[model samples]
Target: MKLPLKRLLGIGAIAAIVIVIDQASKFTVRNALAIRETWTPIEALGDYFQIVHWKNTGVAFGLFPGVGWIMPFAGLVFLALIVLFYKPILNGSFSFAIAIGLQLGGAIGNLIDRLNPEIGYVVDFIWIWKYPVFNLADCAVVIGAGILLITLWKSDLAAVKKAQPSESGDAFNKNFNAASAADKTHE
Candidate 1:
């Protein structure tokens, strides 16, 4: 379905905001924090916030290997997804689009740091796990992914519910059976 032009533009604007916020925060952190320095945890709901200086050559929570040679490969994946899913970003619900924006923004932000830095590692300077230190870009990527997963789950559920009754109807059942059989035959 075609999205209203206004909504489309709004989503674009929100995405822009994500990019701005993500980059600006990273820049601020870079300027303010000393590398490898850990600050006292900033308490929130249960001791979840803090600002420090850290870097990761790896992926989510520093899971993968070091910066090594994987940075460009991962960056390519990010770019591909953004390009492949551009339609969803433009046409999906407002929240979903914002989620995409956050994901994209976070990815691009970290990629910038990794690509530009001498060691090519993303600066990651916030920790709550006594965990591998992370930064705003990491937060954006995680939260955005969560949002995407939730939205996809919800959409799937909706589709299932919407399909069930139709599947039971006599005419729909006939058409569905034929379609299913046809699909099987093609496979």
Candidate 2:
């Protein structure tokens, strides 16, 4: 399917928003907090939510601790793959476009950090309960993936419903087969 210019623009706009928000938040945290510093937890929420200053050299939630070197390359490849498969991935679905936009923005936002030798790490600050501290980019990626998964699941279910024979159709086929068998035996 040919992607409409309007849809492409819409997706680009969403991606820009995600990147801006992610980068701005990261910039703010980097400037305001010392490394490893944690602000007091929200009083009403107990330890459920707080801001911290931490550096992550790995993927989301700080997994793969020392593999930072590969992130920028991976991000580049990811973006390229998105462009190569843009039509199929979006499939003219607005929700899929939005989801892909979020993923793309997140990938770019973190890629910038990985490529910045001065920083050499992504800034992460959001902490909630026992969850690993994360940042806005992570949020965008996660939400995008979730939206994609749900929509794909719903589409699959719809396809299955379409493929399956309806109850009345099934009944008619069964009756026709039985009638044919009886007629053959009598003849």
Candidate 3:
């Protein structure tokens, strides 16, 4: 297959996997745990990690509450933007593809909840002692964002390196100028 096509396919595959996993895990959590219920924390980890049943009508980390009604449309727009810019993703590096795929998957996963008015909230279960409860979709989005930052940082670094003149060339020019000055002094 052509390179761009192959890359796109790979991206699609990763996104599908993430979406599936996110949805499945959410389903299992909802089925197994009642809202506001919690399992015992693992003793080895102290309060660091536990499973809890919670729901968020807001954005990630439980922010921006009371906007549940708007999220479905927003999710649609987000997905549309991703589709529109997909060509750029295909042409970019592997890390870019992974980042886009992961973001896409996470968006879709949460979008599913938004679309289901019956649910009205995104199911969240994963908990850390000091942090708000979140779910697989949230995890995917955060990770994807982090990867995107790394990719951009690396790209910028490479560009800077490319724009810089080689040290050897600078040293050669300095030596040549010094030798010419010596010749002029002798003359």
Tell me the alpha-carbon RMSD of every candidate.
5.5, 9.8, 10.6
What would the per-residue lDDT of candidate 1 be over residues 80-109, giving only the tens digit for each residue? Answer: 976676655556666677677677677777
How does each model score on TM-score? 0.72, 0.83, 0.82
How much lDDT does each candidate structure score?
0.67, 0.79, 0.80
Which ten residues in a row are the worst by lDDT in model 3? 178-187
True-vs-predicted CA distance for residue 173, candidate 3, Å: 20
Supply the global lDDT for candidate 3.
0.80
Model 3: per-residue lDDT, tens digit, 1-187? 9978998898788889998999898888889889998876577875688888888888887778877678778778987877787666777788988998898889888888777767768988888888998998889889999998988767655544444344766855554555554334322
The candidate 2 region of ten consecutive residues with least summed lDDT is 178-187
Better of 1 and 2 by lDDT: 2
Candidate 2 lDDT score at position 138: 88
How much RMSD separates candidate 1 from the native structure?
5.5
Candidate 2 regions with alpha-carbon error over 4 angstroms? 1-3, 164-187
> Which regions of candidate 3 fall more than 4 Å away from where they truly are?
165-187
Worst 10 residues of 1 by lDDT: 178-187
